[model samples]
Target: MISKFCKEVRQEIFFTWIMWGVVILGIVGVSAASGFEHTVTGAYARGSVRWLLGMDLYSEGMHGFLYLPHAAIFYSPFAVMPAWLGEPLWRVLMIGSFAYGIYALAGELEKRYVANLFTVSSLVALPMVLDSARNGQMTLLLTGLMLLATRDLLRKEYGFMTVWLVLGFALKPLIVVMFMLIGGVYARTMLRLAIGLVVMFVLPMLMASPSYVLAQYVGFIGKSSVATDPYELLYSRFCDVFGMLRAWGMPVNGELQTLVRIFVALAVWGVCYCGRRMWGHHLGACLILTFSICYLMLFNPRTEINTYSMLSVVLGIYVGWAIILNKQTIIGGCLIAFAVMIAFSYEVVHQLTPGREYWLPPLLTCVFTGYVLFLMVFDIRPVVKVDRVSPTQSDMLGVDAEKEAEGLVMTSSVS
Candidate 1:
């Protein structure tokens, strides 16, 4: 009966579409039902309007824009549209981008594997996707761009990859760390990336005065520095290693935190560099990309729950690979089940004990990330094995088929 059910699911296209439909409806439903009065995107929209009016981007007691001037220039179009229209349009675009990115990655797998991609991704990404949609956050869009960039990188399309990376960096400058991973593998891509950066920096000058753009950049750096201070009120939002340490009663001094983050990042990068040869295989390459993203999320000092949207992509990839490639079905099923539970950990904990969900969710994510890193380094093996065989005397006797046939005929005649 289980085999019959598996066969039916494999053959059904309607089920696949239904799964995708659920994901789309879920994103739209969550976005429309939630408040967006204080979102990252809204902040950008407000900042764009302020910039046009010659107002200071940063002011006292205001949750002013924290992004680069280029971000304001990008948000100007949405800023002009009324919120009623703009908000829905932005939500739809983010959802579409994320869906397309998942589809593109799924294209790498075989048809049998592709059918379950959306279902698994939706389950694993439920919390983060819903949170991003509800809060009008850029995390989904950033994740999509990063996935697109990874696809391009795997195809050896360095120029296009750089474009994707540049767009992601424009939205969140910390993504620039990805360039180091790319550069180590494809050194020549750095030239294209440099050009992209120059264009990104110069394009804002065309929209706003050079001096104004320069001032905004300076203001962003200064404000960002203050925001990253562990003692600052805003730092409570951080959910990375430093934040967890601080939450656990550790004396997380800013300087020490910076050093620790740098050391961890360097260690992860060294592992990647050492395993650079593994990129020749598809699974190895995916693992490397996923590891780099996981490292970024864990190491970045400013990460929050919204920032974890990127991990959904990693989870989706890992679950998909396990289902399609691993021989242990029970293990794969358990992993998928565990991932779903983790995805909804916050909601479950919140319902049982409100306000106590803070540490557990983030801590669980950190533990899961460590497990993923370990798998990337040690669990993955080459897809194909090299075989060495030497023929025995019996095998050698079989080599002369004509002689053996003659002998068999002579013996039959004697009998």
Candidate 2:
């Protein structure tokens, strides 16, 4: 039986869904009408032309294409179109992808919870949607790909998952971290991912000369290295641990930042190892993915606020699971409250402080995400059902007898 609190949460989620739709439509309409010129999409559009003409794609400053050369091949069709046509088309595509992602993720929830999926998801995603639309960022497309990947993962469709995951990686290399982490648990998926990467790399050579492709790759590496340099003025936009330390007046050079990032990654790897058994369980897998995605966003030196769009689907899943469990622990409540605060803190802080204080929200978000990771690692336990599994079958499946007795057995079924 559903509790009163759960019912209330569902109601709130339903309303949030309606509000999210209204907000998305409003933003899209405004963007289309305003004809924003200086957008990330515009940069990609321009970079596509440069790639075709064999011009220096990375010399155009921050607006230049940071994406791999093959990405230009994909964007060329749209780039060839006039801005009047391409900008609107791009906006429409982004908005459509965002809606599709939300819908797909919502479909993954239980029947009762599904209705609130978009509503609850918007709590974490609305700001990102706004930011992505405003800046013409690729995050909405990335978010959509991630949602598709997660949905396929839940359905045990590893082939589809690999396709979406690799596509996302092609768009942004940071998602490669997710691929590597998940590969540790599912070796077969990793093999498919390697094949997919090879295909993606080869497909671009058909459009550009081999030498041109080589140069593009070299330029990508060089520019990315420069872009992520801690001493660079653009590094101020970083919101990860490295950025937080730098913001607090700590002397963090590129070398030191890279070292700290490596240490943090090792720490995450250790936590994942310790929780390795949990991967076989539904809630446990979701929690691990949540922590991993948060880690990717928080540790990557190039991360910006819009990048949080990638967390939309995972955050929704985490919240839905937490609510379904009806856990009343103080720590759980505090985590939920803290997440909500972080979600809304930007507006309040912006009003109260100057523009330079903009870093506060992302910093607090990083801290909150870290706490959530800790809770998932040490505190959260998977919900298990013993009635369906006999002792013999449990033993055969490698279920820990002691953990099973404590109601911590992994289930084969996702829901």
Candidate 3:
């Protein structure tokens, strides 16, 4: 009887639409309230292009483009096109990449409908597109790349797939490193990663910058270290780390920060170790969430709710949960309700407080920590079942878990 209902739910597309409808409405309401269009647009338009190329990078005293070289490079192509051409073109590119990512993720799960649900729901169901589009941010593109690389990794296509991920690292080193932490350190992955970095990072630098320009690039990286953006949320969150340690009266210095980073890195490593042994995508999802949240917390001192771009990755994890977790216990249901409440409740909180100066750090910390724990524990499972590979998927050079599992476990792949 339960199985029958579960199948019915799985087949129900309207339910997914309804859920997404609510998400869309919420995004619209929030954007209107936040006044994102005018503010975000004005800021980016005023940013200097020369600085972005690592020449006068951060010369005007803003981390605008210095910290994000990968985004800078990709945006360079669109930068050449007229604004009218570039903005819309970039938006379309995001949409296309998102579609590719959905195909990749669904392929990971071996379910066509499941992947379609991810593409449609994730595209329209969140504020990602609106925010990325408004700010001309590459958040969605980065997300799509991360998703695609993860899907490839799961299928054991370590070479080509990891390139997408390595490119993401070159763009925003935080989240990609997180994914690597979760994927664990395998020889094949390491080799692929090295090759990808060479292609994506080293080659790009060599081609884009002359020897003299390369020296300037090194200077820019150095300047970025001392540069602090107070308005950035991640930087503020790093302050929180200091505040937390200081409250305990521990001197929050470079050494402490380094220590905390090491610990977080280890935590990421453990999560990936488990993920490597897992059947679900939760490991990938959790690593992305943990790393993104930590990155935002540590570096983005002025990140506002609008800049919660990485949250979309966590939302992807939730969608994965909806598919994999067949059992919905009251406890689990309550937790899910809490997650939804917190994710959607920020709007309400904003209305009530209207950005008053109060314990924002603790609130963010609690929310991020809870969500990561949820993904690692409830969403990811150790055992996964994979059947015969689809022809299209096989043609894509898919890995057969059954073949990989021949001398290992029961019948399916673990790790």
What is the clash count for each candidate, in the order shown?
A: 0, 0, 19
| Model 1, total clashes | 0
lDDT of 1 at 71: 70
**Whole-model lDDT values for every prediction:** 0.63, 0.63, 0.49
RMSD of every candidate to native, in Å, equals: 10.6, 5.9, 7.1
The regions of model 2 sitting more than 4 angstroms off are 1-24, 60-63, 109-116, 233-235, 279-281, 324-347, 350-355, 377-379, 382-415
**Could you give candidate 2's per-residue lDDT for residues 30-88 as a string of tens digits?**
76677764467766876788888987677634436788876676688779987766776
Q: What does the lDDT read for residue 65 in candidate 2?
A: 74
Instruction: Sort the candidates on TM-score, descending order.
Output: 1, 2, 3
Q: Write the per-residue lDDT of candidate 3 for residues 1-415, one digit (tens) a residue.
A: 4355446545544455455455445544554555545323222332225535445444444444544444555556666666555555555565456545654564465332222335433543254345444454555666677667766765667675777777777665645554465346454567667677666655546645556346645755765665542222232323344533433345345554556666776775666566545634434443543465555544343344434444444444444444443233453344344344434544555566554322343355556566556645775332333344444443433444455344232221211
- The 10-residue segment of model 2 with minimum total lDDT is 406-415
Write the number of the candidate with greater lDDT, choosing between 2 and 3.
Answer: 2
- Stretches off by above 4 angstroms in model 3 are 1-55, 60-62, 68-70, 112-125, 179-184, 205-209, 228-258, 274-304, 323-347, 351-415
The superposed Cα distance between candidate 1 and the true structure at residue 3, in angstroms, equals: 21
